[model samples]
Target: MGDAHVDSEVRFEVQGRLGVIVLDRPRVINALSHEMVNRIHAQLVAWADDDAIERVALTGAGERGLCAGGDVVVLYEDATSGDGSETASFLADEYRLDAYIARYPKPYVSLMDGIVLGGGVGLSAHAAHRLVTERSRVGMPETQIGFVTDVGGTWLLGRAPGELGVHAGLTGTLLGPGEAIALGFADVLVPSQRLPELLERLETEDVASVLGALAEAAPDAPLLDERPWIDAVYDADDIAVILERLDELDSDAARDAATALRGRSPSALAVTLRAIRIARGFERLEDALAQEYRVCRRLHAAPDFAEGVRAQVVDKDKTPRWHPATVAELDPAWLDGVFEVGDDELRFDIGPGTSGIITGEHDDGDEGARE
Candidate 1:
């Protein structure tokens, strides 16, 4: 590989003519920092204006991640003093970047190699071309962290194959390459070793061409494909029914999923599932994002999110006390505020509505990595 490079708090480089961005902090599994967010935004905008740049590739700096998600330690710390005010600010800007990448102009590629979860899911999932490797391990996982899946996941999850979105949101389970692709969370899957060679080729090849080439060499199936589950259950509109089918998996995979779901906040799961359903058939991305913002504001204003994070991450208690513990106890009115935006609440200014800024970026070039 040519190894053309740029380094800062994170990293921005070029492989031949391709713009390559690496999430540089490896210590906490490449947890995203605010500075990295600002830099990535700046670099991407700069790249957008450069005529010489044909494509861009985004990756992580360490062995374990394309990115694990946002800095949980930071989130936990921010909420420690009974001030969830900071949490709102972090999410607002983070979602803005997620929207930015989703709408970026050039070929934006995400090499989802390993540990792609939560906010990590946001950074990559919306890209036009997502490449997963044999080592790829992806998930939404925000339910476990006391947050609903932010970073535009509510919209994506709302639309995943069949009932898969509800399944993922409720359980916070991990999805391997095949499962990710099957769920429509990823587009292509290449082997781990061929990555560097592929990046070199990306400088000259368009996305369609690299996919054509990679397809000839790669296998047909994902590592842990979820076609069976998706076909049988993912399409079900009802969340409770999905659980019944999952209980019938009769395999280790199903058992693992069931166990993970048992530990999550049921109220969060229920609200999340409904939010996804309402978000469906949405004509624009902002419509969906605004809906998510409503849910988040309620999360902080209420007791679940902050307290959930407290017990699970901050206090390390592993025993979150979820009020209205059952789905049946939840009220539809809880989300009305989210849908009906207020003066202090967050709202996106997507095209045809406000700034007409780009919100859905498609990766036209096989820029870096594909799922």
Candidate 2:
């Protein structure tokens, strides 16, 4: 009923009772550009008022479905020429939408399929039901792109159990469905081949039926099965320790991860680790997002973000001249500066509202006693 006729990067459909939103930029692995964010917000608002749209189930087009994240080239261009206002503006709007999704009414179902990374994780992680498939290859590789995982990732990852949060924070390594679900980043694991049939069933079933079928869906990856790497390196309290361990390991994956870290902007990595650590005990999704916003604003002004992005994306060269030799060489004062507010901010005086529970509400702010 509302502006569904116009064209956009996203497509909206009603499969019986379920309102399906598909991310359609298959050219970029369905990456979420700024225009896509606005389209998503508009459709969500439209769906909120439409009585026919009983529930929303979101996914991407093509066989490799779901989303990756914001196009970095767009962000880099926006941040060019000492005018980062556009990029900052994009972060503010995107973060607000993320907080909204985390606190939305009705059932929010996300098919966490395909390359669900940076911006993609922002969309799915906050939903009422998170369904990962064999295709899901999830991570927040913002550090590599000279960006930190904003959009409430710091808060969400902070709330993740143990040092795994910090592990994801620093290295920006992606995880498979098995690893992601084991770490509680995803809720259910379904085979990719069966997802279409399940979505069809969900279009007509009651909420109970939808969830039961999802629960009954076979887990394509067994997360709880032994994953030796996460427990070893990810278990560290800080990035320094994690890097030290990574340096020690002689395995190809370990060496690759360490080499990748060496190539990233050292300042970005340092700030990212601190952001995740400080994100502990955030009371609401907004609070966590506020902190992330602060870091994003300061990140570009620092040395690493631009250098990292230029080396990786713009220069078409794999080499980045990271300032520090290792995580240890990162200056303490510079690292602390990210959390400081020197005017710019993303915040609100939002009143208490009940949305569905996320992975965070499982605790009673008892992270300290356990950690």
For model 1, the superposed segments whose C-alpha errors exceed 4 Å read: 1-8, 216-259, 328-332, 335-339, 345-371
Error of 2 at 306 (Å): 2.3
lDDT of 1 by residue, 198-224 (tens): 787888888778876774233344423
Q: Residue 135, candidate 1: how far off, in angstroms?
A: 1.0
Report the Cα lDDT for candidate 1. 0.70
True-structure RMSD, every candidate? 4.8, 5.5
- Candidate 2, which ten residues in sequence have the lowest lDDT sum? 362-371
The residue pairs found clashing in candidate 2 are none
TM agreement with the true structure for every prediction: 0.82, 0.85
Considering every candidate listed, which one attains the maximal TM-score? 2
Which regions of candidate 2 fall more than 4 Å away from where they truly are? 1-6, 214-238, 248-257, 349-371
TM-score (C-alpha) between model 2 and the true structure: 0.85
